[model samples]
Target chain A: MAKFKKSALKENDGISAPETTSIAAISKIKEKRRQKKSTSDLVKAILNGNITALSQAITLVESKNSEHLEQANAIIKACLPHANKSVRIGITGVPGVGKSTFIESFGSYLTNIGKKVAVLAVDPSSSITKGSILGDKTRMEDLVKDKNAFIRPSPSGTSLGGVARKTRESIILCEAAGFDTIIIETVGVGQSETAVHSMVDFFLLLKLAGAGDELQGIKRGIIEMADAIAINKADGKNLKQAKLAKVEFNRALHLYPVKTSNWQPKVMTCSAIENEGIEAIYSMILEYKKLTIDNNYFYSKRNQQNKFWLIQTIEEQLKNDFFTNSKIKIELEQQLELIENNKTTPFVAAEYLLGLKT
Target chain B: MAKFKKSALKENDGISAPETTSIAAISKIKEKRRQKKSTSDLVKAILNGNITALSQAITLVESKNSEHLEQANAIIKACLPHANKSVRIGITGVPGVGKSTFIESFGSYLTNIGKKVAVLAVDPSSSITKGSILGDKTRMEDLVKDKNAFIRPSPSGTSLGGVARKTRESIILCEAAGFDTIIIETVGVGQSETAVHSMVDFFLLLKLAGAGDELQGIKRGIIEMADAIAINKADGKNLKQAKLAKVEFNRALHLYPVKTSNWQPKVMTCSAIENEGIEAIYSMILEYKKLTIDNNYFYSKRNQQNKFWLIQTIEEQLKNDFFTNSKIKIELEQQLELIENNKTTPFVAAEYLLGLKT
Candidate 1:
């Protein structure tokens, strides 16, 4: 992870008067291009897979600069036809589960076999610091240099689910760009994991050899969602424990009814550091894909996930809008204080705040 | 629990009109109520503490019937001024933990001490099967017989968390009605438990001894949220394992950071069947409340819960609105079939659906 000095990318500089005017000019040019370009132009670009335009378009969607949102929507509409061809995989584990390392090894194996890979991180922690170690780009030196590999770090935002509103938009951009495998790396475990799982085609849970406490911390609801569990760091003395965990997870997976796809979930072990068993992990995913496809689960799962994202996105936006209202904000603090002082209950405070907005 | 046949409730036939018209009337009534009723009017009624009105108001809030919602909102607004005086306690356990039996015995103890108690269940099961069980009010026969105590089986026809919402609202109405304590019984051992915990002052997790696989199924997130753990059925040959599980859970709890509240979470043993150690559990909750109040955490926690509920309610409403959109629904089903056929991916389908709406 490349740690950029604060001096390197001054945040305030982007909005300086001269820069602002240039940005305005660029915005005008973008607007003209948007007005003139047919959807076919955009689709062709996406199909020929122009990476820079795709990235720029994704940035536009993520941008708080409202001016860019329209353009972003247009670009996405144009690219939609060529998108949704890839297998979107979501991987999660606790901090020490070696998520990055596993992704690096696993991603490398896929690319080595001529598959184009795109690795994205969903880091909720990035929201506070706005500085993420994984997003630094320099961390995955090998993957970054590979012709078939694409690595994008978490976007800086408040949403814990890695990526952003545009991440889903970007997945289409990636698929359109000819990247057949999109791996979403979420900050290990918690609510954010659920966010990632909801959007992906396949869900992989990475676990350590002895995550007894972790196993307890992860809710059964989440466990039932995983399509496969891979015990990572299964080397040296921990191998036995990893195997044992695999057995335990396998048994736990059985308690759930057969999946809609009619395919049994699988558990495996791998050592990301050693790069051993990575291929087997890939094969397992392939087997799952095959089973799901044959059972007609692949398309249905994707459709459900799509519906989930659309609703999720709208819900998130509505929440943001509700909280951001100036009138609501002014009353919220006072109401919260009232609730704290026992002068009012939460139900009452909420009613009052909502009343103010309406 | 009383299992009144469906035939019995059907006799109240005229009450079964479609909710739209009634909901509209209730909404207007609620608005007029907000404008006219003084806090005293709301409180006076609650201090008289009518259980039927409280139950009806909660029903209004839970029902899709617009008219009832208006009245429910009005009642809640009026009751708001008098709510939150009681200690709200949340209890959850895996299925087969003898939850109903424990509540029956424990509730009887509270009433014996001259404390008016209200027990509400948040049913997580499906709505079709729920009404049958909703009639099973005979489970807590003793508590039901006690004029000072109220036992409400789970409210039927809502989402897993929906039941909790109704339960939380009911707690407010119960408190207004002068109940000294409100015990929320969860749907058991999963996401619903978290929903229950977020709304209460103290959270209790109940468990059975030697429930090996059952214990493993308990989500760690719920365990971490717990303020106390009780090993139910701790009175017989199972005593040894219950004690052992207590040790294990105690150690597990230690791994979590000390809760923000002053009290160190406690682990205890109880036999609901034998009616042993019931009072101790109540005392522990009282002690927790006292400690949190002394440390100034009582009001703060309530404030946080209020904020959480406000945001949660809005989000749920927003999602419901989005999914219920007629255009989105038609497009969604078509896209879902395409996805099932593997002709398109979720990302692409989402983009298409979102595009259609825009």
Candidate 2:
């Protein structure tokens, strides 16, 4: 370790002939080494299914500090080769649809069946200035206590894009730690569902029984994105209504154009509290996985998602940098004012604001 | 005209003196004067509702010649003050859903009510190397012959964005030429429907009656964008099924979340050849217009759309510029290969390709 450190420092000295042996610089190098060694240890531990290391690595990934982000990147780089072995599933539901309870039930069932399950969340709305639905952390008590079940709450206070980036990287860490089934839970109301859907192999939406489907949050775009719908809380008095909803949801799904995946989205009923039909939903996911794998869509879809995220991240960061430029911000505001007053068409205004000739 | 031309050319003399009266320069000035006089005359004639001038201006807007583009820009700038007076409606349907025939029937109804109508096509599919669906021209025979109606076919062989830009500018020209009602038609299968939806005050979709509603072309996103649906070909034995389809559609729409406009989209059945329900559909548009305008949503929605298009146009162009760059293309392909091989995560790969130390 000392020899390697000396060689690395000497290479830096070769670039800049400053202070390879100075006390101040030496202390800084020692501090960096301490942080780096911990990150390396974390990766090693995580690969051995050490849950504590997994949690610490995730905390680093979710940290807003620059130093933590660098170390998190290093840990993620080491974990990448060990990831992508899990079947990722995204689950979403409205606030009252019992997503947490369902996940707890579902997670416990998977663990009982000898599957190591990791449950993560992408909830940007927790950052909303209004009251956030504090549902994930407190609702999954059983899963939190299970040795084979891991539950992580959504990272608080960030944009959906930021939260998505963190949770997605954390997925790699979880997978590297040997979790075979990964579930990404999101609230159906926000743009987070789209982000979750992009990273998951199967997307499931949970809905309540009855005409409550008319709730103002479940948009057609979300419904169309679902690979399956589980009508939750379908025990006892609500059983008939839940069955009816399943039929209606099936018909509604049929009205949609055929999905590109060629997999017809199924609707099922499950009472997470009663532990009814939870096994059926898992079976459905396995069926979808088997079907997609047979057709090579599993690998192809992952490849497409990787490319999608690559371009999306690049474009989004580029846009952020451009928009945050002080000059661009002032000019953009002026152009928007011009458009509002009808001085120019939006396209012409954009061209002008972008420094192109009129 | 001669006096203005001489003075305009002489402004160059105010800056430089050498070529003020040279024969070659004088002849070129005269040639420019001839073109400028005709463009000004074309604008004058269009403002007087001359169909021939209207046709010529649209041709210029659709042209690829650099000189024609400059003139088109000048014409569009001049026409802007006289535009934005029309209620622009976007109509979309599958190729066989009888969009042109419905427009023909609807246009004739409007013309009979003393409203001048202009129908414009946005068909990017013609650019496909496969045989184009040339249905617009021949399907609207009656409207083509009507004095108060102007039917312009799609600008052939361009992208959806290019075609949208052309059709949007053409609507301005048509509005300036006294067309109080403009119908922008798009085939629903492609991304053109979104483009059409962006520019129009109201969006109408035409659907056929049958199980073919599950056809892969009609994406749910497009359906969600519709402000109204007219089930066409309700004249024959399809009438009963069409009525049933309307009820089903209304119910299906209810299952989706409410739109921000706060105006519930309406569905109605219509028969183009029989002219059944044509006027009722028009009445629905007026009612929607009244409600939205009363609730102040119409203005707000239009503003939102303008802002959306401005940002969308800029981002898409920026992406095109970046992806088309020689350096970025090669680097992007390499990063994609790395991602496909699981050597690096997409976000990290993107960062490296973008020149960041990941």
User: Compared with the real two-chain complex, what DockQ does model 2 have?
Assistant: 0.36
| Candidate 2 lDDT, A1-358, residue by residue in tens | 6657755445444455566589888889988877555777899999999999999899888888998988999999899999999999999887788888898899999999999999988888765354334343577788888999888877775578788888899899999999999999887546888899999999999999866553345665787889999999999999999998888788778766767677899999999999999999999999999999998899899898888899899898767766777887888888888767766677777677667421
Q: Give all TM-scores, in the order shown.
A: 0.75, 0.84
Docking class of 2: acceptable
Best by DockQ: 2
Candidate 2 lDDT for residue B31: 89
DockQ, per model, reads 0.18, 0.36
Least accurate stretch of 10 residues (summed lDDT) in model 2 chain A? Answer: A127-136
What TM-score does each prediction get for chain A alone?
0.79, 0.85
Clash list (residue pairs), candidate 2: none
Candidate 2 lDDT (Cα, whole model)?
0.83
Residue-level lDDT tens digits of model 1 in B155-258 = 67547656766777778788878888888887563477778888789999888867564446566477678899999999879888888888888887776677
- Output the lDDT of residue A356, model 1: 68
Residue lDDT tens for model 2, B1-358: 5657755445443555556577888889888867654678889989999999999999998899988877877787788789888788999887788877788889999999999999887788765354333343677778889999998877875578878778878998999999999998877646888888988989998988886453334565776888988899987789888988888788777766778878799889999989999999999999988988899988777778778878887787767766778888888888899888878888888788777322
